[model samples]
Target: MKILIIDDEAKAQSLLKKLIADLSLKVDQLFTANNLLEGIDIIKKEAPKIVFLDIEMPEYSGLEILDHIDLEQYPFKIIFTTAYQQYATEAFKLSAVDYLLKPIDPDELEIAINKALKIIEQNRLSSQIKSLQNALNELKVKKIALEVPHGIIFAEPDEILYFEADGMYTNVILKDQRKRLICKPLKHFVEQLSQNKFFFKPHRSYLINLNYMTEFIKKDGDYILLDNTIHIPISRSRKDDFTALLRETFL
Candidate 1:
């Protein structure tokens, strides 16, 4: 991942760089620009994934970045770094952008980086979906692309037993007992696979393929047993509806 820091103050630039290193972020290239123009040049040339832009600059303030570049055309994540508190309101007006106060907190910086990574991953996932659709049309088979840090994996929807939510990522459990970690939330997969009749959300964090369900146990608490023998809870609110649907479909 490429990161560009656009701040005139040398100290601020160094501090941010140090903090990023300390946090152990996966930044492949870290570029520093003393002004917004230089930053824009680097952005056009290098195309950094995340940019730490300072709102207060020598000539062109970071806010002017909106005027300089067509953000809609080149969608890179930006996190505004400024000492002044007043600019926070304006910075948030831009969608999915984060604003951090100067003398940045390590925790906040880490959080902002995570948010940026998620958004970048989402963009990649979107592209992969488009590619998947085209490939499916040509191949005449149903498949989805799972994004990992290394590359993409194409898998059949029926091969996926379930999806488990893990913090900012999701764990995809396959029918063969292989578990693959993807850099996207479970909600994304739920929405992407909503049209498929086999997958159902049994709980907030789980989307299970009904074909893999072996048993629905309701002894002490409601839960489900899958083909791979993993027991996952069924949400109380969804219990009645889920049971009714299971009966209607299977029994």
Candidate 2:
């Protein structure tokens, strides 16, 4: 496998390279480019399987790469690297685009690489990039992409009742009483939906949208009842925080 890293900062480039090495990915060739144009040139010539692209470039943002390269023709997965925070980062999650925040963590890098491999195999990179571009340009995105075995599900955040962990998979329960089993784990959703204030992880095995929570039971066990009439337990450690959040929201 061939991999490329594009970033203006030499330090960032070096750090990512070291991290990739630490992860021990099966990379036959590892390329680096200082800027977007250079990265484009490398892409055209080398055709790496994966590209760790820096979004905040001097001349062109990483999204601008879409303007240069025809993704349909040159189909390679992109793992965006960005220093942008809050709103901008939210767009990435909403679009189901893989991104690493600045001062990247090794675990995130590993996860992103694994995801890119799966997407490349499924040949679903083009639509994801299009959605990401639209989200960044518009600066507001309400829907999120959920990857399942058959295909991807694009759904509004409010439509989700809660996420339940089933070992390696996550069961996403919708308002319409549909359960979509996702390939990724619950922890992935927790991080992806962290910015969405309504979603709360009351237990390690589940993440629930607070808006769907209809009742809280304290006598029998710490559990929350959602509008869908499903009981989700609140972890002992998270009980105080969950109660406080409920008070803050309803009070």
Candidate 3:
């Protein structure tokens, strides 16, 4: 696969290179650009199969390139490399395979790569482009899963209320008064799940299902409740972000 790195950060660029090298993945070639203009130039020349794009730069932003680029003209799959927590929806809008948060984890990188491969192999260029746009607009689908005694207890994605971390376990709360214990860590699933505007991370330990949210409460700290029944704590670090995301998705 041919890949392009579009970022202003030298460290980030090198890190991605190291990741590919470490994995010994088959990449025919990799082209790097310091800014969007150079990135676009390389895109035209290389016509890479995948683009690893960073959102913030002095010369240009990731979204701007997405807005300007022609889907048919450049048929590469997109994988968003961002430091911001807020661009999850934006990534999906570009039909991005997955969003890699900064200080990128190797596990997260692996998951993103898997998702990207599936999207490109199964979808047409137009669909890929439209999905990316959908991320900026509104997420099309809400996927909810439940876990029982064994493993991932199958439940409709739409039936979930919220997710809360109980020590190491993440609970998938359903509207029908049942809570499913997801075996995997919340962070692990979040990286793999498709982008959804309604599903907001109110706290590091909690991933809220917006479909069930009925009230937002702010006091000494920030926290949210679903249907006025399920209460989840919002850590101090994520309080401001939680509020902002709530406003963006609901208000």
The best candidate in terms of lDDT: 1
Better of 1 and 2 by TM-score: 1
Instruction: Work out the TM-score per prediction.
Output: 0.54, 0.46, 0.48
C-alpha lDDT (0 to 100) for residue 169 of candidate 3:
72
Clashing pairs for model 1 are none
Winner by TM-score: 1
* lDDT values for all models: 0.89, 0.85, 0.77
lDDT of 3: 0.77
**Which TM-score value belongs to model 3?**
0.48
lDDT of 2 by residue, 51-83 (tens): 888888898877677878887677678888888
lDDT (10s digit) by residue, model 3, range 1-251: 88898889999999998887777478889888888888888888889888998888885788788666897888888888988999889778877777889888988888777777777777667678888897754432343445556755555556767777777678777778876777767885566453666677767777777788777788755667788887877788877777787678667
Per-model root-mean-square deviation over C-alphas = 17.6, 19.7, 18.4
Residue-level lDDT of model 1, residues 1-251, one tens digit each, is 89999999999999999999998777799999999999999999988889999999888988888888877677799999999999887888766369999889999999999999998899899999999998777564477789988999999988999999999999998888999999999998998887777788989999999998889898878999998479989999999889788888888
Given candidate 2, what's the lDDT at residue 174? 95
